[model samples]
Target: MSIKINTYITILMLSSAAFISPLITKGQSTSLDSSQPETVVQKKYGLDPSKPLAKRIGNTPPEIIQKFRDAGMSPTLHRLSKTDSLKVVRAFQMLPPLHQHILKEHLLGISFLDNMPNTALTATVNPEDQFPVFTITFRAEILKQDVSQWLTEKEMSYFTKDFPGFRIAIEAGKLDAILYVLLHEATHVVDGSLGILAMDQNKGTSGMAVNLKSFTRNIWVDRTSICPSYTDSLTSQSRFRGGGRLLPMELARQIYQSAAKGPFVSLYATSSWHEDLAEYLTVTHFTKRLKQPFRIIIHEGRKEIFIYEPMKSATVSSRISLMKYFYAKAGSSVLYERHVKPGGRGFNG
Candidate 1:
């Protein structure tokens, strides 16, 4: 896949140029059971690794921040104001209960920094468990953006250089960027926790194994390569796929046209099956739940050249069946978005 991968302390982070940096403190939390012995119980409040993220928000430790800098990521840690921290709360609330449930069970906390190279990434909190605790870091700038701007900006980065007079616009609505990004990054957590992307081998589960064949089985033979039938010569070499050079804007029409016929929801979804699930679910949610139109408007000097709407394809609709797992509703709202009735089974959770 063209995207970067970093595996640190068992499992780390995944984003555009993904990194799994060591972004935790030296301290670890232990169970309250008297059966276990401990010397000193040191807690750093919001920074404590023992507590799964509750309400408090905090920054990464100074040393961990330096590690990210050394790895060529955001070098400056951004201290959050009270209003900024509330933004995170609002974003977390916007998530489907299932997404929040998965993160609360395994995620440690979220971090923020200025000038981040990626939208978001996950790091280890307690790496010893089969399911390690996670911490996700965000580009502090998300607080200043809306979903439309963030989605458009992130989508634009796939191409190498900009098109002189042409620009691609992702016409999603004006929701908060934190909600959009947090949804995408947290879905990775769901995939890592549940086996939605059964293709991933890094989720910390020790026993609750999922069915081997995933939603990606027919579409992707492996994490990176698409099935022969789905791979178009034009779209396969996308700059997002480790292609030798960045393609020009003129090529976008053909690339997206080829992708619309395929099962993927967006061009970036073609990066990896892991990304496929993330993009597919998030983009679909952006459209269906929020009732926003995910239109890729290519404008040439204020005149529209081409407009690509990804949802109209029959291929994407066929895959909507796979989405039942994400929407299965139950009293366990915290767990399943929707419940599968008899005769119909959802993602083999």
Candidate 2:
């Protein structure tokens, strides 16, 4: 039963990555301001030019012209509700100081997009800025929608038991799940902005190459050593989508049991290197900082089936050191000391 659960969870995670939508989607046919230069964008937006972003962005506040606003990309899209808007804004602010600085400045702008299904969250390199000015677009419906209903029965049951307020928080628009999704997508923006995970492209048409020099390699190889089934090719990889391949309820139960003994935080973490890093960081932040529990228990008519506590996984727990280095802030360090083990090796590279 446990082995079957592991197999299906693995399949669901990998499939979720394979079907992620494109990063940038245009609305109302709004073209980018490609003529704008990097320096000019920085100056115009009041972003800090002195502080350059490489891989490790230190803890510093950014000078941002705008915090959050409409994308002006489309007329069809409507404004987000006050509760939802405040929730999103507060979520960004809740990030550790180090990440707060990077996001405030480089994040550029955030807008609501109703065109996409609630399941979609997208980011794009703002055309107005040459140096990684990102405009994040969230499917507006997501904030008001009960996305948890989309989870598989096994996932639903596990979360309900593990995270006490899981469904209630989602309904009230206060769950870390929304914040987790935001942080995960925001990581991509930071990764692209800092060249931490650059897309390798050749001069001709051999298709883009995969480079693991930065965060990608650290997660795929140095950290968890992601299963080959998830990383055989870029096409097979998965991101942090709310949906994945569905399995029979019985099979789903088996998969969850098998996953309990695995190294990854959640089954979704096995989708790809990028997702692995994002999922690890998000879950750690949720469980450690937010005081939430990430455990899995299956029951067959009252008898215990299996139990999996993510924070206790040998492989998953080892990455706490890397998380500390990634943030390198007082709060994150303290969180690590309080929740995760005292120390381990920091970032792989």
Query: lDDT per residue, candidate 1, 88-124, as tens digits?
Result: 8777777776676566655667778887655566655
Candidate 1: lDDT over CA atoms? 0.60
Q: Write the per-residue lDDT of candidate 2 for residues 8-60, one digit (tens) a residue.
A: 11112111223233343111111123553555665665555344322112221
| Total colliding residue pairs, candidate 2 | 6
Best by TM-score: 1
lDDT of 1 at 337: 23
Show how many residue pairs clash in every candidate, following the order shown.
9, 6
